[model samples]
Target: MTLLRPQIDPQIFSALTPRDDFRAIARWVEPRSSVLDLGCGDGSLLALLGNELEVRGFGIEIDEKGVLACVQKGVNVIQQDLERGLRLFEDQSFDYAILSQTLQTIHRTTAILSETVRVARECIISFPNFGYWRHRLAVMQGYMPVSESLPYQWHNTPNVRVLTIHDFDAHAHAAGIQIIDRVILHKGRVIDWGQNWRGSLAVYRVKRYR
Candidate 1:
């Protein structure tokens, strides 16, 4: 698929341009496919996809402000918590399901993953890598790392868990989810070598093992 840079509205997004994770996620989605975005913040990714690929997209967000932002952007969105699972969507209702940069904060990881795959042919997920060198060094020093990807103090953070590239790969294997494609990123650039130790973020495209 040809990836086009998304034209972002400054009013809808804090950043004037699409983030690297968004671009990476967009690359995997085919044009005009149906998409369900879980934990979609401000509907930025949906809007981007709409503009670039003309995808039929719907967003699920819990925050009132985020729901309002999606409306303002003319994107279809619903206000709902992801922990409850995707009961509203039927089997394979969408071509793709996207959970970008929000997996760590969820309490029911396995349930959500199952629901995501059940409701779509494939799912794309992105999250901060807990095994990056900086995070490891901080843990070694007896502190949680604070960086652009993870910018919260331990007490105030919403993250319920942390995992690495290997951690996720193992989890996917155990859960019978097939990881079809993966990309490791640091500072918006793809890392081709030493991904577990060097990359700060990870993205995966997956589907049911069967």
Candidate 2:
């Protein structure tokens, strides 16, 4: 899948990303907490979370274009290669660290997740769910699904790994990271998850024991 939808035109703001997602995310973030955003992309979520949550926010992004976008948003951005792992920050340096949408692209999800737990009291991670029915059908039919969330073509897709909701849960458990909260996003709306498998996206708040 193409990480950046070149033909879709760059959007300054997307009402497509619902406030419900932010509201869900806001619940886990206390006001005035130091927040670090990994693979922060264009800082849309960081800027929104920072402004609404009243928290100091830092963004780490590897893409040059994304770094520029973060700068434009006035988000505190550090342009660095994340695949190298997080060794520069001190332990417990922030209240929360966020890894959103970019987890699938990382070569080392375990390392990055561990780093987030080590650097902050809490962590939030969100990604496209590869096990959604549409994805299942597509794979069964021998074609990669191009849903709104997973909009990349398989040949040039940026996602190195595709994980399901259960897969993420298992990995988190193995890492000893507890799930503090979970939310599923679908068509930009937060849905009641008694039917959450129908949703296209999942967000999780995670933390370590100590």
Candidate 3:
């Protein structure tokens, strides 16, 4: 039996059961390009992008373990706090900058997203939908939603600012960022247009407008 290393794309080791944590990310990114992953946890997605997509990627993570994981994968990674902002990087330094699932954890999406557009020509953002029917139902039932996508209890949840799919679109407009494309995923399936609000989660591609 081979021991699984965190450096490798989790897929390289069969013993590890792969989950959808990185699914929306891979689907939104191009196969061959430069990418920067903000809030890169454990460097799993960067490894997948490099190995499977053949993309040169950089990962910025605050975790020591995650930084080490990227290094072991032969990926360029930086240890930095996103909330402090990206002053070191120049404008449009990368083809794409990804902020997956991390949107809710940051203090300010407005400023963070501005940095994303400034640092990269394009950006990919995916987040949990706070306005999901189930979430609403939980309020009615007097209990927070505990579904698979959002599995944690209210008190222990890591999410700070859960924005709905519609809320994101509005922010994009306010930021003057153009949506390159957007898609919603529900139960591991892609939903067509006009139904994203009703869907569970969503990923979007955005570009800074002139």
* lDDT tens readout by residue for model 2, 12-35: 444325333556677788988899
Q: What is the TM-score of each candidate against the true structure?
A: 0.91, 0.86, 0.86
Tell how far residue 42 is off in model 1, in angstroms. 1.0
lDDT of 3 at 149: 69
Off by over 4 Å in 3: 1-21, 193-197
Q: lDDT per model, in order?
A: 0.87, 0.78, 0.77
How does residue 99 of candidate 1 score in lDDT? 91
Q: Whole-model lDDT for model 1 versus the true structure?
A: 0.87
What pairs collide in candidate 1? none
Residue 208 CA displacement from its true place in model 2, Å: 0.8
TM-score of predicted structure 2: 0.86
Better of 2 and 3 by lDDT: 2
The best candidate by lDDT is 1
Off by over 4 Å in 2: 1-21, 193-196
Model 3: lDDT equals 0.77
